[model samples]
Target: MTSFMEDYFRTALSKELAIAPPERDHEHLSSTSRLLEKQREVTEAETLLANQKE
Candidate 1:
């Protein structure tokens, strides 16, 4: 590869890594999962109710 291409890739990668946030901790991940599950359950219940009216 040319020097320009290598420099471009390195700069782009560094910028992307810098812009991205760190990974969440275990507890945070579980909390998010629980909230998402609850949201799904609520959506399912709402859909059932809506369908029953049909």
Candidate 2:
């Protein structure tokens, strides 16, 4: 209600928004999913090769 309170609230909200992580857009999520899937595949392949060595 007062000017000081309004300014304080605005500053706090700005700081929080700055510290928060960016929203997960579809493209970003898709790329991340693809990367994880590739990593999993590589690990599985490495495991299979190691087993074959035994």
Candidate 3:
């Protein structure tokens, strides 16, 4: 009975937390590129601020 209850709970949790498949690889790549662009902009801004302080 204990083993049966454990299996039931395991199955229920598995279904509840199932991972969804990625819909599109292109969308992921574009988002990653955008993130990199934002990081570059931030670095440039920091450099400009440091130079102005000197």
Q: lDDT: which candidate is best? A: 3
Per-model TM-score versus the true fold: 0.46, 0.46, 0.46
TM-score of candidate 2 on Cα atoms, chains taken together? 0.46
Q: What is the alpha-carbon lDDT of model 2 when measured against the actual structure?
A: 0.66
Return the clash pairs for model 1, or none: none
Pairwise TM-score winner, candidates 1 and 2: 2
How much is the lDDT of residue 11 in candidate 2?
Answer: 63
Q: Where does model 2 exceed 4 Å of error? A: 1-29
Could you give candidate 1's per-residue lDDT for residues 1-54 as a string of tens digits?
687797688668755765333444547567777687668669867965774574
Off by over 4 Å in 3: 1-29
TM-score of 1: 0.46
Candidate lDDT (C-alpha), each = 0.66, 0.66, 0.69
How does residue 14 of candidate 1 score in lDDT? 56
Q: Give lDDT for model 3.
A: 0.69
